[model samples]
Target: MSTRFSIEKLGAQGDGVAQTETGQVFIPFTLSGEVVTAARERNHDRATLMAVLEKSPLRIEPACRHFGDCGGCAMQHLEEAAYRDWKRDRLVQVLKGARIECEVDELVACAPHSRRRVTLSARRTDAGLLLGFNRHMSTQIVDLDECPIALPQIAGALDMLRELGSLICATSKAFHMTVTVTASGLDVAASGSGRMGERQRQIAANFAVRHGVARLSVDGEIIIEPQKPVVMFEAAAVPIPPGSFLQATQGAEQIMADLVGQHLARAKKVTDLFAGCGSFALRLAKKSEVHAVEGEAPALAALDRGFRYASGLKRVTTEKRDLFRRPLTFKELNAFDGLVFDPPRAGAQDQCRQIARSDVPLVAAVSCNPVTFARDLAILLAGGYRLIRVVPIDQFLWSPHVEAVALLEKPRKRR
Candidate 1:
């Protein structure tokens, strides 16, 4: 049945929420203050947008043709000012939920076509191979002709990658491919595809070379390596391992790094926990001696090489240890005057506990998940650390995800 709903607000998942007789109903692709006609699913509190009876002033035309169908982006219809405000409000709301109050800086916007890494889904069908992002909330692939959020090199290579997927697909099963545009060239990594025969391997290699790919790998096995994929971290040109973790956009990475470096400018000794490929460590080492710790051996090895090759950088040491299994103890953490940690989405709960107990004078916390970041910040607040400021960075662009860099400092006790 069709029902008229006045959208009350936008939910955390970028869905418009409406209060109905039963309860709140979430409708995708609707905006706040807009009267929308939607068909409610039977026995479900959700509705699909049918038409907009009243349009919102904050609503703008989405830039991409596949905006509604593709699951890659959300909130693309939001106006620039409204979108940035919404993202910043998300951070503020998350912190308030945890009973932590602080000043949140304005949202740092990332320009369009700035994303350097993108993961695409591919599936083989009777007609041909289907490659692009999966349909919204579905496994069906939406074949992409253009993506405005990705780098030109990556966006332009979609057809080329689709062709490559045809030669390497060993079965009718769906698979994942991650394409990263580095300083050298495109680094393509395909996984979940069945084993490749010699003939298939040869074909894949020839296709990669013809397309000028820096390196191509399947299931962590290198098929062809025309050149090492290198990514510049400040002054260092670090060679990235296949399928390694990188910041979604270089602009966001630099913003986060600058915040960390500026916060710990005076500290002579610093420790970087959960450092991935030395994004912050490399930049901070220009002024301070840095000891970077990470769980991935390959990432730490890359960081070490970056430090070794870079000129005029301070001493940088790396340790391969799982911070989750074995967080640095309070005593161990005391060795550094300053600390910076960029944990995964789950946040550094265990490490934050240890940091809470320690007396690290200066600390910078970088997180992509605001909920966990708020939890960790509460822990630090209980430990008598004052939050200086938090900057929300729109790294994922139209997506709901946001990155933040928070600075904190503990007062020195007088003897």
Candidate 2:
């Protein structure tokens, strides 16, 4: 039914909520107090905005040309201060939902084009090869002229990347192309591109060389390396594996590393759980001994080598283990004076459960998903850990995603 609706508030997923006679419906690209007409689907809460009868003052021009259709950003239409506030409130609301309230520091901001990494989708249509991000919750790709959220080097190279995509377009099926701008050069990794043969591999190798892409890997296999892809984590230069996890922005990373380092500065020994490429471990090692634990051997080896060559650092060790299946027992965790775990979006529920039982005096938890972060924090709170402060960091600029670092301390008596 096409009907007029008054937007009540913004939902958790960046949709505007409106209460209907029957129930509530969510409309995207809307703001609170705005009156808009939308087509509501039967038995569905989502509505497609048709027109805005009344506009909110908060609504502003989006930064990118492809704001609504690109699916790369969510809140680019909202005014700057309001966007930041909503992002910070996202963490607050998640914590409230988990019944864990504490001081949430102001959000650390991220700038446009600061995104050093992005994953693009590729496919060949009648027009030509399409290379860009997919539409929201969709398999459809939006061919791009420019992407304001990505680093200029990557954004400007879209035509080149599209041309290169044609060379490796093994099948009609879409594949993911993750491009990361490192200290050396662009590291391109394509997955699900079907099986690549010798001809395509050689062409892609030559393309990487001609374009000066530091490395190219398909489906976790290196196709070519014009130069070894390396990134600087604190003082260490770590050789990163293709498609390895990296903080979206260098500014956000430095802020997180600084927060983690300051939280555990007094400790003599620190354990960096789920440490990737030593982003926090090597930085912490300047003052305290660090044991970097990660699931991927390549990531762990990269960390070890970064630590080995880096100067003026304390002792650093590495362990390859999956914490989700085999969490460090409380007995094993008690050996560390401090602990920091930066888990993936699923959060670190299993490890946090073990950390709750550990008498480790200090703890710093970092996560990209607030929902799971709050769930894990509740587990720690139940085990007598005091929540100190949670700082929300804006890593994925203009997107709904936010990063957070939660600091907690176990009581002296408990230790």
Candidate 3:
């Protein structure tokens, strides 16, 4: 018999931790304050839960059948309200630890199930094309017949794609086929296709003909009718390639822009760092002078196009520069009165350092990774910045990730 225990707290990755007599174990979908039975032990001294002896008040019945298997969403089992509160607590803890005074506001709730886009990996099995996400921590594919979180339209296409899988030879030679469904149509990419030369092209053509996709791309480049630009928020429409980054949820993205606009409206001039396709810059341009900086040259071109269509007036100055390699100096950084950052998972550590030490009056740091955000916030705090407002945005629902928009004001000098 395995000794079991109750979870004390939720970890950063959404795992519930419980230390038994033997050792500590991380269990998924199990909430803190819940007692569970350990089923069996696995490699790396891990233990799986057999049954929940007692459920926490924060526990909720999982809505998805493939909740544990899919591995896409880790916290759907917890009550939505409790899950959000935990996220808010994480940010508060970060600020408190640094001795920064800030009002952690209510988190913006995202639509529970409205993801219009989904990228699934397809494997060639003896039976057929296994289409779904990967296993918990392994590359082994967990074939899902249906995904609950995906938009209804995209989820419907999974069956069609799976049935059509064997008809094409792209499955045999590729490592894993990529299936992306956009507003236009489906796009597929087949890697490890040295065996199929012309066959691969013909397969794509045949797939396009059968499904009637408005656009198709084998790799990053387009192969069929060009995909129309995606309309972001309520106003801006950007022409993004298949692999290009777009906010996962269109509705949530609009909310993000609204919050940014509200914040930037107070500033006379703002600098948006890692501003891919002018996500925040173009919209802020409607009210203030926005200097958008991005590493990708093509993204800047798209940002320019968005500006031309969204607003004929050019309040945005797009600069193509790699901030990681060469961070903007304090002298150059002082040009902006306010700053908005939407960096990648790495977060804007170096860029945040530059902003803290600069003379910018107001700063807004938006990040997807909380760990890096906290670290960067500490740097800003030490440099005479006072945290005023923190707004957590649940753009990726049920997932462990949390996005936040933090407003920091430079501390006033004491006479």
Residue by residue across 1-415, what tens digits does model 2's lDDT show? Answer: 6789999999888989999877899988899999999988665688888899999999999888887788778888899899999999999999998999788999999988889999999998888999988876578898899998888999999998898888877888998899999989999899888787898889888988999989988889998887889999877999998778999899999999898889999999999999988999999999999988999998998899999999999999999999989988888998998999999899889898899998888999999999999999999999999998899999998888999999999975552
- What's the CA error at residue 141 for candidate 1, in Å? 1.4
Candidate structures ordered by TM-score, highest first: 1, 2, 3
- Stretches of model 3 off by over 4 angstroms after superposition: 1-3, 40-45, 163-196, 411-415
The candidate maximizing lDDT is 1
Evaluated against the true structure, the overall lDDT of model 3 is: 0.73
TM-score of each: 0.98, 0.97, 0.89
Per-residue lDDT of 1-415 in model 1, one digit per residue for the tens? 7899999999988889999889999988888999999999875688888999999999999989999899899889999999899889999999999998788999999999999999999999888889999886679999999999999999998889999989889978899999999988999999997899999899889989998999999988899989999999989989888988999999899989999999999999999999989999999999999999999999998989888999989999999999999999988988888999999999999999999888789999999999999999999889889999999999998988999999999975453
* Segments in model 1 whose C-alpha atoms lie over 4 Å from true places: 413-415
Clash tally for model 1: 0
For residues 83-122, could you state the per-residue lDDT of candidate 3 as single tens digits?
Answer: 8898777777776776766788887787755776666666
Q: Please report how far candidate 1 places residue 80 from its true position, in Å.
A: 0.9
Candidate 1, overall lDDT? Answer: 0.92
Which candidate model has the greater TM-score, 2 or 3? 2
